[model samples]
Target: MNFLIISKYFYPQNRIASFRINAFAKYIRNAGHSVTVIAEGDHDMDTEWNGCKVSYVKNKIITESYLRDKIKRRKRWTVRRITASLLNRIFLDYNLFWGFRVFKKANKLFKENRYDVVLSSYMPISPHLAALNLQLAGHKFFWIADMRDEMSKHPYFSKKYKSAYIAIYERLFLKNADLVLSVSKPILDDFRKMHSSSNYLEVRNGYDYEEVYDVNFQSKFTMGYIGQFYDKIKPDNWFHAFSELISEGRIPKDSIIKIIGNNMKIKIPDNIINNVFEIESVPHDEAIRISTTEVDVLVMIHPLGRKGVYSGKIFDYLATNKPILALYDPDDVVGDLLRETRAGFTVKESDIEGIKSMILKCYSIWKNREVLPRDWNKIKQCRRFNQTKILLDYLSEHLPNQ
Candidate 1:
């Protein structure tokens, strides 16, 4: 079976969604199925990837170019947009331009070769719009709208467009596509309430293994978090949780806390500064190796308001085999996954005593040369290689001989 995947990024880009699609493309090809990807890039180019093919669709229009350049200049930070023009003129309008370009290119590609299945992955949601155009125009294919994250519950939308308009938009998107998939259950629940007729499912993100350096875990108790830090994830709260312990000298002053890849510059006491290591963003493999081998504990911060926002980092952290210390909401997907897998301990974001207790427990294990009681079999359940089987099964159900 030949599958056409439409995404905004692909291999060599190394974004969250890029890793998922890249791993799937390789795994599917290894399973004796051909995979073709339509992704965003500069200058149209074709390449063979693990026995599959990839086509690049260039964004060449003025509005698209202007928005792209502005984003590039801003270093691709969406939060930097503060004006109405940035909100109304570029984001809302330019994305449609991007959709038009994607549709034009995808329609041409569809004509050249017939596809058994069409998988449109979303981040910007332009690819879905483009594929929706082709599907609506009587193109025949089993269309699957895959949301790597929640589209309808996206936090970017303000009060004016949050609930009413986005819900309708999500319904239309799901109603048009034959099947819909999201990264978490809450995301599917958000869509299912409005569009009960469409096929809704949850597809958890998986970790992709890569090369890493061999690093011995240091004698000092280490807790590492290797990812970006933004408004929603409040690391300072964790510090406040430890304030009493640190001040009382129960926790070692030299105990290391590695906040790699991101540094929010939390104002810890002078005594703790030597123990706090803030590393700037490093390459993916380096980040993984450090988290997996160098740290005794991995710290993960859950978002405050984004209910269904499950970062791809969760599975990656799980694969590291280090016990996770999740400062999370019970509503976030990580809460249940951690409890179910027994891979980590979870504390409410505001529960200072709970956070302190978890750290002390982990420290006790580290000091006594004891292993974290992670259910290895359960942890394997979320591996990226294993996830391909789910995708393949879905394909077999929809298109025979997958």
Candidate 2:
């Protein structure tokens, strides 16, 4: 099968969408299928991935030397307006302007030689709409809509948008798709409520095997986190959870708290600075090696908000079989997974005392060398690669195979 993947993020960017799309494309290619990716350009404009072809597009008008020079001089003021006007003209979806040229090339390529399927992943929802355009142009390719996050239904949306407009748009658009997939059940449930398509499914994010099997677990008392960081994920809360340990001297004052992602550049609240050991972001393989060197506990933290905002890091953390400390909303998807594994504890973010108790308990478990029952065997069987196979099969059976 030939698969054309449309996304705004792809390899070398190292964000979630890029990583996820790369995993699928690699697997499908390994399975003896061809996969072509259309995405926004990073520092590298046009390139060929391992076995896959990738192309990028961006607006030419806004990229003039004069505009770039002016922005360089007054970036603090002119950037917003420049971005808005430039992006609107270039991309069908304003945010995905970098993919405009890529999509045009893809459309031309599709016309020359048809593909078996067109799969799109969303952050900027333009890919699906772009696929809709291709499908309308007499192309019989199967369209799979992959939603890594809830569109307008995300918790970050204002009440007005979620309650009214999004419901209608999601229903109308998704109804036309051959299949709709989300990373978790809550999101799938939201989709099912508005659209009764049995075509809907859940193909979750998973760990990379090389990251799990290749690295040596080297640290004795180091705690680690391996993903992007942002304001919503309060590092202070993590510090507060271990405050009792620090006060009582259970964990050494110099014990490492390594955070290995681009998030080091984000502004962190001053309260948490004393507890950290910083490492600059690296390539995925390097990150895996760095994370595996840690000996103590593995921590995954997210904002304590609505259910379903689980970072992809949690799955990778699970595969490592380290003692896990997941700090997230009780209702979040990652929290639910921790409950299912019974491998870790989920404490309320506000209950700093409870979080302290859990940390102490985890430290004790770490000391005892107790191996909790991890579902690594199950994880290997049900990752994104295998999930894509299942998705293709379902689409073939239910939708046109063409």
- The numbered model that scores best in TM-score is 1
- Give one digit per residue, the lDDT tens place, for model 1 in 1-402: 888888876876646788888877888888887788877766678877778898876654423334445543444444423442464443543355556777877788788888878888887668888788888877898888888876656766556555455556567788898888888888888778778899876767888774222324558888888776766676777777666667777777677888886644356656566777788667678878788778988888874567776688888887776778888886577888888877788877778888899889878867776655666677776878787778778768766654
What's the lDDT for all of these models? 0.74, 0.68
For residue 246, model 2's alpha carbon misses the true position, in angstroms, by 0.9
Q: Against the true structure, whose lDDT is highest? A: 1
lDDT computed for candidate 1: 0.74
Tens-place lDDT per residue, model 2, 1-402, is 788998877776666667788888887788777888877663335568979988765434343333434543545346555665665444323454444454676789797777988898876666776777787767887788888888667764457744465556566568878888888888888778777864788888876664254334333556788775655666667776565567678765555577776433443334345767667667777766655666567787776655676678776676666767877777677777787765567777677777787777876766676666766556564466776676666755775544
RMSD of 1: 3.7
- Per-residue error (Å), model 2, residue 141: 2.1
TM-score of 2: 0.84
Per-model TM-score versus the true fold:
0.88, 0.84
Model 1 quality (TM-score): 0.88
Q: How far is candidate 2 from the true structure (C-alpha RMSD, Å)?
A: 4.4
Can you tell me which runs of candidate 1 are displaced by over 4 Å? 60-94, 210-216, 263-271
| Candidate 2, residue 241: lDDT | 58
